[model samples]
Target: MDNCLFCKIARGEIPSRKVFEDEDVFAFHDINPARPLHILVIPKRHITSLATIADTDTLVLGRILAVANQLASENGSPDGFRVIINTGRIGQQEVQHLHAHIVGGPEPVGPMLKRV
Candidate 1:
């Protein structure tokens, strides 16, 4: 994961608009946001994607979700927010690393997805 973008950000090799960080997790604002409040929460250690997670990865995974509310409220979305974790190619995952997107704002984010 040396060349991984998220790993770089987690290690401080790349600069990001960091929102929250702890021993095992890092949260930051997305450079290209889809919503007024958009943040990416990732694990400090690299995991290819949600599809690749092992049992040991559960703690960090849960930690990411556990902080979503606080991160959303502190950054902008006080009322509520949406947490999305895109997996592999079928999920339109832009990055290989495992991460969850916290998206929301003062207004509703609209429909979760267009009807199929």
Candidate 2:
């Protein structure tokens, strides 16, 4: 996992616009944002993807969701937001580490695009 980008971020080896962090999770602004308000929530542990999550990770996953909600409310998008977790190569998951993307605000209106 030494080459994993998110692991580096969670370990504070790389800088991020962090919005929240605790013993179990980390949330931060996405460098390549898809919406006006975009954030990435990730677990401190190195879980490859949702497909690989173990039963013990259930509570940690729940904690990540709760933290995402708190972040959305604090970031001025209390009304609603979208959370996404790309699972594999076909799902467009660039980073091997599991993470959730929180996006909200006016939906972008344009032609269908491959990239978010």
Candidate 3:
């Protein structure tokens, strides 16, 4: 996990435009915005991907979504928001650590497209 970008971000070893952080999670702005507002919500501990999550991770998973929700509402998109978790290679997970992408805004959001 030493090479994991998200882990580095979560650990504060690398700088990020952080929005929220607690004992369980770290949320920050995505370097590349897919929408008017884009943030990445990730667990403080390193978990490879969604496929790697165990049943005991349920609470943490819910916490991630809850953090995402609070962020969307607080950040000015009260009407709605999108939470995306890319699981593996085909899912376009550039980082190996599990993270959720929270995106929303007044502007129209686009469909998920494959990387070319």
Candidate 4:
């Protein structure tokens, strides 16, 4: 995983505009954002995708969602927001590490929910 970009970010080897972090997860602003408010929430531990998550990682995933909710509320997206997890190459997951894209603020393009 040494070449993994997200792992580098989580390890602080690569600089990122971090919004939140804890022992289990890290949330940072996306370098190439698609929306006004776009952040990527990722687990400190490396997991290729949702399809590869282990049972023990369930709690960590749940925590990621909770953190996303908190961030959205704090960022004035109390009404609603979008959370997306692109699974594989066909899904447009450029990065191998599992992460959630939390996007909101301003006028969102197209439908709020669209399969990646």
Q: What is the TM-score of each candidate against the true structure?
A: 0.97, 0.89, 0.91, 0.91
Give stretches of model 4 more than 4 Å off.
112-116
- The CA lDDT of each predicted structure is 0.94, 0.89, 0.90, 0.90
List per-candidate RMSD values in Å: 0.7, 3.2, 2.6, 2.2
Q: Per-residue lDDT tens digits of candidate 4, residues 9-109?
A: 99999999999999999999999988777899999999999989888998999999999999987875676789999999778998999999998885654
- Locate the minimum summed-lDDT window of 10 residues in model 3: 106-115
Tell me model 1's lDDT, rounded to 2 decimals.
Answer: 0.94
Residues 52-98, candidate 3: write the lDDT tens digits.
Answer: 99998898899999999999999868888989999899888888889
Any runs in candidate 3 off by more than 4 Å, and if so which?
110-116
Better of 1 and 2 by TM-score: 1
Model 2 CA lDDT for position 12: 94
Candidate order by decreasing lDDT = 1, 4, 3, 2
What candidate 1 gets wrong by more than 4 Å, as runs, is none
- Model 2 residue pairs with clashes: none
Best by lDDT: 1
Q: List the pairs of residues colliding in candidate 3.
A: none
> Model 3: how far is 79 from its true place, Å?
0.5
TM-score between model 3 and native: 0.91
